[model samples]
Target chain A: MNDSPVLRVRNLTRRFAAGVVLKSLDLTIERGEFVALLGRSGSGKTTLLRTLAGLDEVSEGDVQVSPESTVVYQEPRLFPWKRVWHNVALGVRTPDARRRAEAALGEVELAHRLNAWPLTLSGGEAQRVALARALIREPELLLLDEPFASLDALTRTRMQGLVGDLWARHRPAVLLVTHDIDEALLLADRVLVLSEGRLEADLRVDLPRPRDDGETRFVHLRRTLRTALGVTDKQAIAA
Target chain B: MLDAVLAQGSRIGLGGNARTTTGQVAPRPRRALHLHLGSMRRLVSPLLLLAVWQAASSTGLVSAQTLASPLQIMLTARDLLNDGTLTHNLAVSLVRAGVGLGLAIVIGVSLALVAGLSRIGEDLVDAPIQMLRTIPVLALVPMFILWFGIGEMPKILLVTLGATFPIYLNLYKGIRAIDPKLLEAARTLGLTHGETVRHVILPGALPDLLVGLRFSVGISWLMLVVAEQVNANAGIGHMMMDAEDFLRTDIILVGMLVYALFGLASDQGVRLLERRLLVWRPQAHRRG
Candidate 1:
């Protein structure tokens, strides 16, 4: 893979009528890199993600990226009027749209649900379908905003593995906004912490593919990330 | 086969069933026929009410001239049907309703879409439409006749005026009620303004639009009846007025029944269209 930067955000700031939500935030993502954004609620993690995805306007600074970038949201956001296959295909009407949709569903292990309606799917299944929809576009930059936050623990873990596998295959530059430190360590090459709308810490992980959750390196990275965000052991235990 | 299918699974099949081929479901047809017959039980109340009315009229509980017997009304309806009077009057009323409803949909939806999309659009049209809507439709019949003449133009104009407001109000409410998060999601996908309207806003407003359309259709029929009563030579409403003058209670009763039947039939048609269009919507307990 090329080592050039695929997405660059320089001195980005956003303000609402109430107050500033983000101030002087700068983040750069290299091609084929998986970066995790970790922060507490209201720390502007979502705001930063939205800014990067071009969903929200920035008050100052420039964001430069390739034309092919897509975001997957926390909720599936699949059209309720569409079937699974149509939802995945969305507005794409190429000759191979159906085949690509089928393959994307297969990647998410949702091939059997091709003709199923959006309402009929379980929460986990719905989120997987959403992921499949993003993947079908073959975006150069993939932004995920806590896509599995609403899933059960078992399903969340399974989805993380599925996402990791898909990323391995697609090799897109990924920026994942998440609250879970362990999830960040498990999937990202670099972990960046946002505290009070500013970049607080950035840690790089030089780990191999399919890293075990129970490994010492994984535990060390997770603890470091939690400590950087000022999350105590007591809080972790409570959670 | 019913027992087998139920035994095989209790949940409604989302994905297609693989176990059953075309030849494997023989008794299913019989069970479906039985299910339909069971649903027919719900119609018993209306039939019983008609029977009671027929008995009361036959027993002379009311004067036959004042409260027509069911047999007399039925015979009158049959005569009207055979002579083509009923069909012609029904056709005229239907045409007026159809033309008026079509115009209402176009104007109401366009105005609602504008009001929903922009603050300026909302400010420009909202107040006047609101004021216009509050004026009772029956009150407008005389004004319409005077302005447009007592012809098809006035009748159709009256129907359109009556139907437009409900659709506009409901559609505007629907547009405003869309979840902000969905729009945010669409924005993240890099959707243009027009694409957002086509893919997100329109679909989001559909359930409300359909509800408005249903109400508008009902209003159109009401307007038709009122409109036809004003210096008209044909239409069910006109027929009813003529019957009243001649003291032909049977013919008047038949006219009233025809209105009721047409309303029910038109409502059923809307329901069918709703089912076909929004098959993916979760089946709610109450239909709009």
Candidate 2:
């Protein structure tokens, strides 16, 4: 593994027509680190992710990331005209691109759907294919833009577990932007809450692997995150 | 979603069983009625019109010289066929239509791509095409005859002019209507512009292009009918005019029927081409 950080953002400022969405933000994600960003709906989380993905330009500051980075959006965004394996192998240039794509689909447990159209896949299956597509690039940095927010509870849990497993295996530096407190707590090595376009809280999760809901540390961290997001103990308890 | 798929599966299963049960339980009279309904759906109007025509002919409601009877028309058709005049004229008209439509496809597709893919090309090519398309090609027959003389050239050119617009317009719309999101995805995936055109834009535009082809083929035949009327010596229109001069209304009816059959045949040909080319479309696989 490289000694340098996988991504470095310095004094990043993003301005929109309305006003400044992000004001001189700074963040660094080291190699193999899992960082989760929590924010309100309009708190510039997507803007930051898009910036890192090279989908948006920053008004000021510098962003340095590995060239082999890939982003997965909330919607699968797979080409509806392409089949499953073809979507995964979109940019692969090897002679065995088909085999590599099929293998990636197998990692997502969709090998049977190699030839299936993107339109026919269920929502969960589509998201899994999106994951396969991102991972097939073997990216050194993976940027996720609320990828699980659209899934149902059951599928979301399964997808969270899948992400955890894949992260353990591939060890890519991941930056996940989401609004769900539990999701951030469960998967991230460190969680940062964005409020008013700046970091509000930087909390670390020291909980053990396969952490359960019954763990006191996990609960404590959840409470801290909720408070940072302006949710009181009463609302937390109700939730 | 899985529930919906399962429900659909069960419905199809039950439908199959229900069809079998109905087939066994239905009596002979009901079966006959069903058969009769199927035939009546297609044949009723034509049979009724034929009966009316027969009554008019037998009762001398109209003279044969004015409006040929159905029997007279049929006999005339048999006579033309035996004399080989109908076959020769039909062959000539078909060749003219084929050559004209072929040229139209080439020119229309070339112009549509040049305009649809680039801003400067569109600015240069689209205005003139838009203006030309609005001037009905039939009205240009006299001009065409004067320009190209009273040979096969003017007739073929008329069909070409008539057929080109539908293809160009539909194909242009199709190229523009491709989803931008898909194009963005292709760009992010690092496909070159040429590759994108081959693998994405063309396939996406194929359905509309096929529709345009159907329209152009229809227009080609319509133009042929008119173009062949311009002092033609050997085509279907010429034969019809000759029959009219001699008061052979039966032969004129025969010519009209031949034109209708040819139009129907060309339309069917296009439909078959559409089905073969557009098999990727999901709706194309669905039965009525």
Candidate 3:
């Protein structure tokens, strides 16, 4: 899997009139690898994801990825006027669009809501539908930007499990941007932390499969990650 | 607790049978027949007002000739219908309104697309359109008459002028109000500019555009009535003007009623089209 990088970023930088959001950064993601980007607000995590998705132009650097890449945004961003089935099948309409949409919805456990309007969906359901829409394209790469941020605690955990299950099934290389450390720890094989537009830490999670949050190793890893992020136990208590 | 409260409430209506709570009593759905009957009952007020008007004229409280009774207006309407005058005038008014409205929609939507999408286009056209929108449709009557003469052209142009601005303004607002994230998503999905406009912008703008079209249709009907009355012509408005000259109050009243009915009918047509086109939108309350 590590023989060649599926996506390579070299000196990727993005700047706005406000200031430089992502200063010269380089990262290479191997095929079928799940990578979680951890960052604080305005840490250029979303900017980098958008640039990779080709939704935003980079100020400097090269992002070389396959053209068959799809992004799931923070918001579901489904067309309000389209039904759940239609929204999932957006842009890739063929004779099999309905069949593919139904399969995707089934994968997200929203098969019963195929004909329901987008406006009627709950936040979690909508985001699941958004994920289904992105996954239906069968892309070589998938970029997710805080896709489960709006979900409640239980729903967010369930979605993290769902993402893990999907990654196991599809084996598509995923680059996910998230602020939640536990979510990054649970989902990513490796997590990269960004601070002030620079990669602060790159750590590999060597935990065993079917990892439990209550396990001693997971707890120790979380503490280590917190320390590396410069958040002391006192600061964690204060928060 | 909620179940206990519901049980107690149900017991009050059913002679204190606790076992009744265990059995699900399906709700008796209200019939559409009863709903229709209720609506008919609500129409009594309008009927009473008409009856009062009829009685006042019959009792000579007001001169019958000055203010025609409902019966007299109905009789005049029957006479006009028999002679085909009413249908002829109605057809004329409808044709003018239809042509004018079609033209307005095409021009309004095209211009709105240009103005809404391109910054340079908006800057160049927005001020001029705003200026034109401020000018009353009636104020353009003389100018249209001079340009196209007192034929059907002037009347159609008047309706067009009245209908254009609302559609343009609403369409532009709808386009601008689309969520930027949705457009970005489309770009990421590899949608070209034309495809994005077709798939994203058009559907996003449709609801507002349909609402604007409803308003525009009403405006067209109003302006058409006034425009048809401008010259010696054959229309409901012209008929009313002629009847007023001859002191035929019943015919004048009938003409006014026809104008009101036509306006309502055109508006309803627009609403029906909106319903068919925007099947995804929830049903909203509207007056008949």
Model 1 DockQ class? medium
lDDT of 3 by residue, B1-288 (tens): 423432332223223121222233322346557767889999999999999999998899867568999998899999999999999988888889899999989988888988998899899877799887655557677888899999888898888877787788878877887889899988877677887888899999877677677677777877877788889488778888888888889988998898788878877787677657765644321111
Ten-residue stretch with the least lDDT total in model 2 chain B: B13-22
- Candidate 1 lDDT, tens digit per residue, A40-150? 999988888877887676669988876788989999998776789988886565788898999999989999999987888999999999899889888889999999899
Point out the worst 10-residue segment of candidate 2 chain A by lDDT.
A50-59
Candidate 1 has a DockQ of 0.51
Clashing pairs in 2: none
Task: Quickly count the clashes in candidate 3.
Answer: 0
TM-score (all chains, Cα) for each model: 0.87, 0.84, 0.88
- State how far residue A6 of model 3 sits from its true place (Å): 3.0
Best-first order by TM-score:
3, 1, 2
Evaluated against the true structure, the overall lDDT of model 1 is 0.82
Which regions in candidate 2 have their CA more than 4 angstroms from the true location?
A232-239, B1-39, B285-288
Candidate 1 lDDT score at position B85: 91
